[model samples]
Target: MSADQRKSPTEPQRGNRPPAHGRRRILITGASSGLGAQLARIWADDGRDLALCARRLPELERLRDELLDRHPHSVVHVYQLDVSDAEATERVVERAVVDLGGLDRVVAGAGIGMGARVGSGHADVNRRVLTTNVIGTWNTAEAAIRHFWDRQDGHLVIISSMAALRGFGGAMAAYSTSKAAIATLGESLRSSLARRPITVSTIFPGNIDTAINAGNPDKKWSVPLEVGTAQLAAAIEAEPASAYVPRRPWAYVAPIMRVAPLSVVRRLVG
Candidate 1:
């Protein structure tokens, strides 16, 4: 069967369970750049508390200052984190829970895509991509879900990609593989937590002008950071099982990507 034709896990309809309001405190990793930074800005503007973590201290500090200046009522905490470090991720998350009193939501957006092409004669580059994107995402998810289990309430948001819908070649090889792994992880969590209070949302975003794709040659249907992120924020608020942001184009394009001729897929995605 094609990727789009597979049956979803057995569970009630995702829409019937709307997220409970008052997700006042949130934790976001990879807050140093790209989509992570934009999500922080939107949440802070809502006057919600935030715990932003990333490897770049300066960027996190700058984001914290920007948020405080625009919304002084919002409380923003910054942390220096390398999500690939499992122990450090656990510690940072624990401290964040203490700092924020409790975390109502956690966005596992920490990842890297180094554009490592297949057969590049160097495995190290692809290794780094997998370690950071797959293992790093796992660290972040485990740390956050630990708290969620203890508190018996939380939201886990896994930021996947449209590339995950099918395998790819060239620069996207490892990155696509990593995303596919985490998408399954998110689906598994959703099934495991079906009876619990915790909610797991998997996001498949299509081409939102970020650093990850700034160097692509044929940039088709790409939106600016703000416009894309606004759609992402809305989807996150809805807390669906899975969604493709800028939903119309993606909702239509995704199915075609799965079933289209292989040559057509190469031209469209490449």
Candidate 2:
């Protein structure tokens, strides 16, 4: 018999099938705490396998143990990773894929926020924020996309902020620019992979009570961590092109924020 004739119709053709959605094997960066950790918990509760990475080993391990205790059937791998390190990011992503059997989704959730006003002579602080938020996100995305391309099925989730809608002056300038860059990166990747099965989703979250914004009095519209992360996980699973978390105000607010005058922005956000 010819090789073509020997093929079974029941067997799926290579690179033709879309990624499985429910109970997915997911890898998340910055999974030690905040939104990342919350996402891990939500997925774990649903009996999904998770590969969690963060610089804080103790926190990651603790989270893993908690997940395992609650859902003994779930598989959780913990890795001490700093997404800013390009080489380490690649290596950890590959390792996670191996450990998880395969990857259905990757969340580039690692980020840092530091106050840096223009001409404040705090170049180091500004640089750190940019490196962690921009370079780190790029490193994670690059590694994840390479694997997704090989598998021809994967979802990439990027965590951006509502601040990305426009340029913010003062201490928020660096953070706003970094988040804008991330959103653009996700959008560009989505366009580049338009023909493929790979999915790219950028999440624009409004204020959430994560450690990053802890003690910040300026966060007027903050939601609880649980509420924000739950909504975020739903969006990530849906595989939408883009989303605004805590959709009520932010979904309505994002459009106006985009076209609002600088004076209005300053009054509203400042």
Worst 10 residues of 1 by lDDT: 4-13
lDDT of 1: 0.84
- Any runs in candidate 1 off by more than 4 Å, and if so which? 1-21
Model 2: runs farther than 4 Å from truth? 1-20
lDDT by residue for model 2 over 1-270, one digit each (tens)?
222322212221222222345537789998999999999988877767788999999999788777766655456788899899999999999988777777889999999877689799998898888998999999999999999999898999999999899998888889999999999999999999999999999999988889877856777678899998899888888889999998878898888888989888767755
For candidate 2, the TM-score is 0.90
> Per-prediction count of colliding residue pairs?
0, 0
Clashing pairs in 1: none
Q: What is candidate 1's CA lDDT for residue 65?
A: 76
